[model samples]
Target: MSLVSPEYIRYFYYGAIVIMIPFIISDLLKKKKEDKIDGTKHFKISVYNILIAIAMMVVLFFLINSNYPS
Candidate 1:
């Protein structure tokens, strides 16, 4: 058996998105109450988290698409 199979890649891709949902939701909820808060730290954190998730997705895509011996 070989590692990094296509099916595993798909699962990793979807898993990353699923894991990010809660963070996204929290970010949205925070935005709704932005008026009450004073700092931009949470916003920055959320953006960073989103960017990291995207990076992971991209990496997974490339890994999955790369040519490898079956």
Candidate 2:
């Protein structure tokens, strides 16, 4: 091993980044009739999603690490 394996945070980072595409697409097509176009809403949603991803990372890391002890 060269150094610390980023495998620890790899899943989380990739997953969170991957979600941006769908989020952006939805935001672009979202209407203002039923729901006004609110940049704030999208921003908040993204932040919330990021936080959830981080939390999930912790859970996943532990869950996976526990199975394969090094």
What TM-score would every model get versus the actual structure?
0.49, 0.39
Clashing residue pairs in all predictions, respectively, total 0, 0
Best by lDDT: 1
Worst 10-residue stretch by lDDT in candidate 2? 31-40
For 1-70, candidate 2 gives per-residue lDDT tens digits of 2156666577767777798879765764563222454434654565578689889999999898795756
What is the C-alpha local distance difference test score of each model?
A: 0.76, 0.66
**Taking the tens digit of each residue's C-alpha lDDT, what string does model 1 give over 11-50?**
7878888999898788678774783477456666667787
Candidate 1 — which pairs collide?
none
Model 1, C-alpha of 52: deviation from truth (Å)? 0.3
Q: What is the lDDT of residue 10 in candidate 2?
A: 72
Per-residue error for 46 in candidate 2, Å, reads: 0.4
TM-score of 2: 0.39
